[model samples]
Target: MGDWLRLTYFNGSLWRRFLIDYLFGIVVNNICAVVVAFVILPGDPFFHCWVFSMCIGSLVMWMADGCRILIWQGGRPSLPGLLGIFVVTIPVGYFGGSYLAAKLLALPVEAVLNRQIEHASPLLIMILIVCVFFAWFNWSQSELSELRAKAETEKAHMAAVERQAMQAQLQLLQAQIEPHMLFNTLANLQGLIALDAPRAQYMLDKLIHYLRASLSSSRAETTTLAHEFELMHAYLELMSVRMGARLTYSLTLPPELERFAIPPMLLQPLVENAIKHGLESKIEGGRVEVVAKRDDKRLKISVADDGLGLETGNGVHYPNHGTGLGVANVRERLRALHGDAASLTLEPNTPQGAIATLTLPYEP
Candidate 1:
């Protein structure tokens, strides 16, 4: 009784369910009205059938909803339960509609109710057809909703797998870089140890400082721009010890941009490329500058070196010239992380050297 009186239906908004069901009832009832007037009860007026259908349909739909809410908790009921609800509700709807129509026309209730008794089989057949149609419609909608939910779950799983795979590839690329940088630094240190004892000790000390600063960020997936620049400063200081006056470097990070987050070791490889391919090749090695600035909504960082401006061959700037593994690593990482939103471009710096500029969507 409480369920029948309750405003809510099918775990949805009461008014929304009512409006939708009422609209569906109108459509279904009109179809049934046409069938009854033309085929089931020949010579019967279409207007009379339509009015009775409208009244019966409205009452039947309301009762069916109440039965579903009570017995099945508003979900689609079992086949037997569905049949029982229809059998009980259809007869009640027909009798109630008969009573209402009799009152409206000021006619005798017995005359109106007894009119359909002789054609009981046809009336029962019509009710059965409506019950089957409603059952099929409900089942199809439930199936479609389940399929849609399943598709969404599968899509989310695929995204998670793709993210994990990309992370693994990035880790492999980062691993390659650390060893390359370490080997070169160690090789230089070994040479200095034999030739100059004091400078070797100083280089070793600087190397320790650089490694200490890098350890934390190296293991992380992301780091702040300020931390990245600090690592670069330590790296440049270590290199300065080796090259003395030959290697001069500057890292410029605006205060506002310092807290922007980026993948770890993103700039390190760019800095390494500038030193190895650009400055180290020149007799009097020139400056390497790393500058970070905002280009509207994007973050742009450039590593520029004024040494042996890209070796031009056949009018091409970079291909014939030594770009190295660092360039490839940086490009792969950016692609995996930001897709088309991030890019790395190498162009000749004015008058001398090459500039590798990294552009990425700013994320804080």
Candidate 2:
């Protein structure tokens, strides 16, 4: 109720509407108020005297408040709503009743005429201004409600877009890891069979264990740091069987980082990239060193291999490099999971091989 009234005096530019609506209601009311006085004045002072009194009073108030109707129906008040506001009560009740009122009170027609001439005063003008402010109050509240509804609709739309974007990123990350891991494990198994059948069987078992973990975690971006390491350990053992005495690897993790959370299969890609492109291409074979540590609020991991390093691996696609899938998949996953909070980088190790390093926020 209060809100509708406030909206009437809105937009300083629409003052004309306010004035017109107000004048219409009061003009109609005064016409009726006169009829009332005419009938009750005993036909002595007839319509002449009746019109003189309330005609001005009704007009003043009608002009003051008719804008109230426009506000009630929202900023753009309908013609019908405006018409209804004044028509419903003025002509049928107040104006017609004024004549009846005079007789009931025993006031002569002359007395009513004198009343109108002196009625409007300084205080009445002040009262009229107060009423205009009251109407403006109701209009403002209604506009706020409309604005709130619009904002909520926009928020819902944006949330939907964000959800779809994240899902697409996760899918891309998962796809990159699978085939890359499969080919690397196959290469390791092939090398093992030529030397020792029994050891090759053990290598196959570790391969299966690591792949199972990867597949199991495919649907999730997050996995425990410990689970990720366990996968890495199994894969490194498979490589050990194939490399003979010419190749070796090590996994080192800080005590405090043991329970931190990270994306699944993140380190596997870098290690595989190091082995296939960084070390296997070299004449002397190599040592792949894997390290994980927490520095302040971030988790850092590095895979370094002593072999002919980065120059041989440049521009080689992940799917083509046998195990390059790990690098590409982890990269995509990092961007998706943390925006720019995590990154994977590659550079040549101190003197001999390539080093791939990953930095990610430490989530306890």
Candidate 1 per-residue C-alpha lDDT over 68-158 given as tens digits, one digit per residue, 9 for 90 to 100: 7677654568888988988898888778876786676677878778886677678867877786786677667556656876998999999
After superposition, the stretches of candidate 2 with alpha carbons farther than 4 Å from their true spots are 1-139, 187-196, 311-325, 362-364
State candidate 2's TM-score. 0.57
Off by over 4 Å in 1: 1-22, 33-55, 62-81, 84-124, 194-205, 312-322, 362-364
Q: What are the per-residue Cα lDDT tens digits for candidate 2 across 260-284?
A: 7776667777777777776666767
Give the winner by lDDT: 1
Instruction: Estimate the Cα RMSD of every predicted model relative to the unseen true structure.
Output: 4.9, 11.8
Which candidate should be chosen as best, given TM-score against the real structure? Answer: 1
Query: Candidate 2 lDDT (Cα, whole model)?
Result: 0.63
How much is 287 displaced in model 1, in angstroms?
1.4
